[model samples]
Target chain A: MKLKVYTDRMSQPSRAVIIFCKVNGIQFDEILISLAKRQQLAPEFKDINPLGKVPAIVDGRLKLFESHAILIYLSSAFPSVADHWYPNDLSKRAKIHSVLDWHHTNLRPGAAGYVLNSVLAPSLGLPLDPQAASKADKLLTKSLSTLETFWLKGNAKFLLGSNQPSIADLSLVCELTQLQLLDEKDRVRLLSPHKKVEQWIENTRKATMPHFDEVHEILFKAKQRFEKQREMGTVPKPGFQSKM
Target chain B: MKLKVYTDRMSQPSRAVIIFCKVNGIQFDEILISLAKRQQLAPEFKDINPLGKVPAIVDGRLKLFESHAILIYLSSAFPSVADHWYPNDLSKRAKIHSVLDWHHTNLRPGAAGYVLNSVLAPSLGLPLDPQAASKADKLLTKSLSTLETFWLKGNAKFLLGSNQPSIADLSLVCELTQLQLLDEKDRVRLLSPHKKVEQWIENTRKATMPHFDEVHEILFKAKQRFEKQREMGTVPKPGFQSKM
Candidate 1:
């Protein structure tokens, strides 16, 4: 039986998992759990993931959530997955793990928090809080600088100065894509200062081609749709709220 | 040369790393980084972990941070460390990783947030906000309840229904120790409902033994000190802030 991947394209980590599977040639069925529709909360989905979040998987009888765990499992469990993604060498793998863990508390919050408070709030039927958005932007900016100043300080093309893209690269770069949802001015203000981060995102994109863009198509489209809605004056469905 | 572990006992993750090494018999020198003294911000420490967080390690030239990453690295790199702490089996390791990642956004924030905004703020030279503390309490309540209803629902003695404890157990149980700082009323109010969670904490503690109590000595002492000060009309040093 093929691995069953339950995900929503709107979720950043969800996108990373799908792309990882595609780029590495892991066969799986994509079961879209709509975040906007509140499908993740359905009782049936709960059995698949008790936490009721996306980017979960069902491998035979085993159930799992948290994209990092799923990604790590896939890399280790699948023989076809390339070694560079999560190297077998102890120290190298540990450094990648460091970046993945760091992404959860640092980059994930900054990027996800800002977008949720600003752009996605209305669509999710929540009020937009400029003050909260501003706070998130500060965090987002600091996280971006950290990625630029330290993680990318070396000549390597990706985070932790790795010449090849690892799961960390996939996860972090997917997180940065959330910025595309922000208004042109706010997005530029938050990210333009970090030149290396810009290049790294592109490098990661180039490394995991076609699949990266293919999986992200929904996200880019949403950005365009939200832009159009804003031009006409507004958009916020607000039927529910999710962590994102 | 000894593996250099830079940490502050006041920090939960720091204690977890130190205990893991002691429990697994990985010999190392403990270099205390004083959170109260703002020593984590020192230039010297930044070289060890650019994030300037406690529970970082320098294993020769490899500088690593984030307790989850450190724990995984230690288990994999150290020859004497037992497999149960981080089993070599792929499925088992992935499940543990899921819980570790889950802790960051869920339990870590709930436990640490409540303590910082309520009990530890004054000692750390910050103001306490009852409202923020209340919010954190709700999240903490929910997290603990989840721990009871799901992670420990099976017959196994520890989380993931395993007879043996993994690093996730160590990391999460240390997070719960922060709740000890709460006043008796608040502490009981928050933890009383979750009978399973309470028992699970004990199970993890017993699994690690002498080291668990040995390492948590500082935290338990702070609790007593805070209680005495409160009885005499209060405590809040307002020195500086750390994540805890």
Candidate 2:
């Protein structure tokens, strides 16, 4: 039974899972779910994931959703690559888990909100509110400040220790890189007082360059979609952006 | 090395960790961090967790934060109770992991938000906004619906499966039981329009009656605190509520 992943390059989590697989040299079939087409809501996809979210996988008889869970599964299933990706040291694992939790509430939500409001929402013909933009800016700033204080406070290069890059780095870097593509104006928020984070971003981008050319290309297309949607005045597509 | 848990009974995650230890017969010392006294922000506690979030545990030289990580650690350390609580089956474990992820974003946030806005906010002498109340309502409804759809769709008894309870059930039950005493309005919402979820709630309550009693007592006191603050004409606690 081959491992199959359902995803869209436009979603950061999907990209993170893809990058993780690529870095580990794991072979898996990719089934792209187009966010613009609302392909995720289709009945065929819904059977795999009742929640109708992407980055889901079916590994033989084992089916899983949630990017973090899939990351862990891949790590356990492929033990040879696990040390570089997940690390077995208890404290290092804790550090990874802590950042992952924080990502869900803070960075992920903020970045996604900014992208959706500025790009996806507008593409769906929804009215963009400057107030929400300001709120997203603050959320991103606060999230960055927390990362600066908590993770990047010392001279630590990676989130965990000195040199080794863990799954935490991969997950976070993918999300932050996506945030940097959220239009030029919105991306300016990334250059706040977080010098350490800025340096880390530079480091991660360099590390990811060799393996993630395809990912970068996909994200570039997503940025292009954002721009085209804005120019075409197709702000807020039907049956896509929930009014409530 | 003894495990040390910093907790407040009013916290759902803290309670879940405590229940895990109790069920497993693992000995641990408890240091209650008073949310009301703002002890979590003090420099002393900040040394351990700069994020200052609870259900933090220290075992020997290793310290772990985030309830899921702690639960995973405890399971690895105590294999005897592991099968009963976390389960060794790969697919079952994946299912639990997926639900745990859902718990963080869905039920945990929405339920905690409702308690904060409706109960905790007022207790700290802060102003109440009906807008937050409505958002909390929508979030809770959606979360519970998904919980029923994903976690409780088939089992209806335990989150994992029949015959025995798992960590997923322990964590989710704590969230619902904690909310039951925090706000009557939230309790009513759990009952109406979510009969499956409500049934699952009762099943969990009946299964863990003794532990529920112990945790419920503290939550009941919290309810009193909210009422006292409401009588004083303040909705949200002044310093604790988000200034933004």
TM-score of each: 0.95, 0.89
CAPRI tier of model 2:
medium
| Residues A137-229, model 1: lDDT tens digits | 778889999999988868889877788999999999999998888777667777789899999999999999999999999999998998788
Give the residue spans of candidate 1 off by over 4 A: A235-244, B235-244
Clashes, model 1: 10
**How far out, in Å, is residue A136 in model 2?**
2.8
Q: How far is candidate 2 from the true structure (C-alpha RMSD, Å)?
A: 5.0
lDDT of 2: 0.74
- The two-chain DockQ for each candidate, comma-separated, is 0.84, 0.55
Docking class of 1: high
